[model samples]
Target: MSKPIFERDPSDPERQKINPALKLLLELGPLLVFFFGNARGEWIAERLPALAGIGGPIFIATALFMVATVIALAVSWALTRSLPIMPLVSGIVVLVFGALTLWLQDELFIKLKPTIINSIFGLLLLGGLLIFRVSLLRYVFDSAFNIDEEGWNKLTVRWGAYFLVMAVVNEIIWRNFSTDFWVAFKVWGFTPLAIAFTMAQMPLISRHSLDEEPAE
Candidate 1:
């Protein structure tokens, strides 16, 4: 029996692979837009004046972020005919929270969006591991990497921990910091932290990697 199309590994021979750069862009594009938009929203609103209706810098940025997220998801779906699970989940949160932020003219909604997303993901991953005896990461990212069962379990645990930690960090930063600081951290700080953490997992990934194994 074959894996379902949705479960096909990203490295699977038959999948219509995206350019690696494009894939990265799709994943990070909306975030970059959000950060840039927030950082420059005042300047943007000043020139465009029409955007003044959006309320403030953070609100304008949230609006742009939502638009970018939608476009990214649409592009991914058009190319692959299936949305990647994690991005889809995140994008949905962005849209929902971003909308509330705009409609209410409140920045807290957008600020809390990351905290909520991370909490949900952490809980789901941990629940799947402890209660269901499964690595929930597989459901969201089976196609992104290949690992042995033990490696998958370890990787899932680490990611679950990381997600929860990130949730707490987001809460702390947003609650204590200025909006500009939060925006900067969201883009410049969190992105590098995530990248570094991913790099730190290279040993685990290589150790459990399926790519080098002989096919049956």
Candidate 2:
């Protein structure tokens, strides 16, 4: 029996590879849209009129974010015939929380979405390591990285910790800051932090890389 359309066989030679730039755009585009929607919610609402029923700026942003996320996932599936696990998981949370935010007219649900998603990811990654002695990160990044088991273990630990930290940070910011500030941080602050953390791991990745040529 053939695998499901959404399940990618990474080892298959025929599997289409997405360009790195395009992949980054697909992942980041929705967040950008969310930020823009929030900043220009009045403008957008006035022009579209239908979206004004969604409520204020934050609510408008959440609705746009949800739509953009669905589009991103659909594009990924259409191009590759598979959804990336992390984004797919995030998208599900966005849809659920976004719906709750819109229907209940409460922005709190949308604010908590990141906290919930990050906590889930943190627990899954750490729990997999603790209980199964497996680095689930390996499965996620295997296509992009080739490293020893030790590297994967260390990477998993770092990422799990980082995710938990992000969850805490999200909680703090949303609780204390204005909605606009929180949205800005989510788009600008968290993204740079994640990028910096990934860059910081390059040395560890290099040390454990299986692709290194054997020294004579």
Candidate 3:
């Protein structure tokens, strides 16, 4: 029997058909906006004094950051129809936390938002494997590369732990560091760390790769 049209299967022919450059753009655009909004907060506030009452650069940045996130998600939906799973999760948290930060006029909420989201993701991914006997990693990565169930479990576990580490790191940085420093870490530090960690898993990925198989 054929798979449902909207269901994502690791072996789907169409899953492998995304435009690599566009995919990268979709992934990176909102992050760029976040960094830009944070970095340019003062300039933006100067041009629009109303933003000054928003508390500080970080607050202004958070507001614009939310706007940028919405735009990014909209673009993703326009391009892909379905939302990208990971970013969709993160975007929802952004909207929620960003709103709280704005409404409460507390930067702490915004600062802690990443920590909460990462912790939730870490626990969810890890708990999914433990309880359901399946790794959710396949949904995000199945299109790019195929892996055996064991490989999926291992990747999921590693990513889960990685998310926890990110949560801890975000907590440490935001609680103790300057807003500029945290924003820099948020934009620059995390992505490279994730990329490096992914590279470290190359052996496991190669071992289980179904790259050459015909779509099921």
Candidate 4:
């Protein structure tokens, strides 16, 4: 079998681990790029006519969003030699939805991308837990923790529900708000909310930790 993506070298005392700080940058970097691209899209188009193909703020933003996401994913693959699951999934969605947005010249498609992605995750996590009788969350968090089966199950359920909640919130915001406001919320609002929720789970994580050494 192939080596696990998150596995650490056993004998390399000087080896570097993927720090949370860098992970945050890797994850949030593309969104920041997208916001900047959209906010400055007019100046960009005025300076570079080539970018005028995807004219207007939203279209230019969508195109640049795709580019930024692809760059982020490529950097992650280069650094780790393995794709992180969530980013991979999100990148794929960005490409597909962003393409449609550019092709159709409609901003709604890009605006609704997050709602669809989050809903799919909610279903996948919740349904997999029910059908497999095991928490699919383990695949992502296993590198960070050694929780028992029951703890894994509880965490998985919580995450699955959280995904659903996020989807609903995205739908409400994007549907009722202006595109620029939605874009700002997508970058600035959603991430902090997720971090807050994850932080709230730390006590539970510590309680369920297996008291084993982290792989390194």
Candidate 5:
């Protein structure tokens, strides 16, 4: 039997590796589709006609977002023979909340999707570290970096806190702002913040990287 996703060793040489750029594109493609679908929902609905029944711009975007997310996950599974833990979890939430949004014609469910996903991730990471003394982040990112245990602990804390903060940020944005603004922030704002935060962790990763050369 195939190993569970969380148990699979990302660093294992036997695992098929996706190109970094393609991997990123796969991850971001759905969000881009969500943004565009919302922005041009009427244009798209006019052409497709079928999507008109889905309701407004946000609802239309939610439907397209669900399809895109499924496609991304399918591609990932096809290439890697296993789903990625983080994206897989996020995709499940997208499908669930997206369905609720469509069936009820309520935008609130879709709006709350990010907040829910981020909060779950944040709590999982934090709980693992604080209660179990384990760095769960290591499993998710082990393929990307070869940091030592100490580095993993520190990275876990930072990422856990970051996820929680993002959850709160998502709540604030969707609650206070217009739908367009929320969608834009989801695509533009959240992406940049995550990228910047990841970049900022490079020094910590480098410092604890097992691949680093020994001092002369």
Candidate 6:
């Protein structure tokens, strides 16, 4: 029988250790909550008066997003006994930006969250590869894939460039688009882009598969 995700041995580096559906929920639950909260913040505030201080719909959503992120991290810690680095970093970003958005009553901070996070990821990946000669992608995805050194290097370069593009795209959308459209795009558009990008990497991944003969 497959080991339950929470019970998987830390020493094992395998994909789908956790149920994929549950993993997706834990990773994305907060974002889904944030989107819902933004769409219904006033309704929620009216029903629960304590949240009136949260200001606008987006602000209320940001506050809830912070709470949800904290919960997700807590649950991850409880289950894994160790924090996942990328999620931890992203969670920290959300809290800091979420707090600023609430304290300043300016939505710009929350709006810039994706841009900042994506840019940091992009720079870290590219800088690690180009300047430090390190492939940070391995740390993030080692469990899911095993690649040759050359493959890792190429994949790292590709992902780094993609992340930079995503960051610029976020900036453009938030700066010029409607808030509703931006929020929806964050949920729908960017996610599809990321999924597509990941899928697109399969050719390179399969070529470098440790378990299979390297493609000629």
Each prediction's TM-score versus the true structure: 0.87, 0.92, 0.86, 0.85, 0.92, 0.86
Question: In model 6, how large is the Cα lDDT of residue 31?
Answer: 88
lDDT of 5 by residue, 1-216 (tens): 655554355556666667778888999999999999999999999999999988988999999999999999999888877877788889999999999999999999999999999999999899999999988786677768888889999999999999999999999999999999999999999999999999999999989999968799
Off by over 4 Å in 5: 1-7, 11-13, 214-216
Which parts of model 3 are misplaced by more than 4 Å? 1-17, 48-53, 213-216
- Which tens-of-lDDT digit does each residue in 1-216 have in candidate 6? 654533333345642244446656787899899999899999999998999877988998999999999999888767666566667888999999999999999999999999998998889899999998988787566657777888889999999999899999999999999988898898889888988999999999998877865689
> How many residue-pair clashes does candidate 5 contain?
0
Model 4 error, position 126 (Å)? 1.2
lDDT of each: 0.85, 0.90, 0.81, 0.81, 0.90, 0.84
For each candidate, how many residue pairs have backbone atoms clashing (under 3 Å)? Answer: 1, 0, 0, 0, 0, 0
Report the C-alpha lDDT of model 3 over 1-216, residue by residue, as the tens digit.
Answer: 653334355555564335657766767777777788778888988999988888677788888888877887787666555566677788889899899998998888888888988898899889989998767777777656667888899999999999999999999999898988998998899889988998999999999876786769
TM-score of 4: 0.85
Q: In model 6, how many backbone clashes occur?
A: 0
* CA lDDT for candidate 4: 0.81
- Superposition error at 195 for model 1 (Å): 0.8
Tens digits of per-residue lDDT, candidate 1, 91-130, equal 8899999999999888999999999999988888888899
Q: In candidate 2, which residue ranges exceed 4 Å CA deviation?
A: 9-16, 214-216
By summed lDDT, the worst window of 10 consecutive residues in model 5 runs over: 2-11
Give the C-alpha miss distance for residue 156 in model 3, angstroms.
0.7
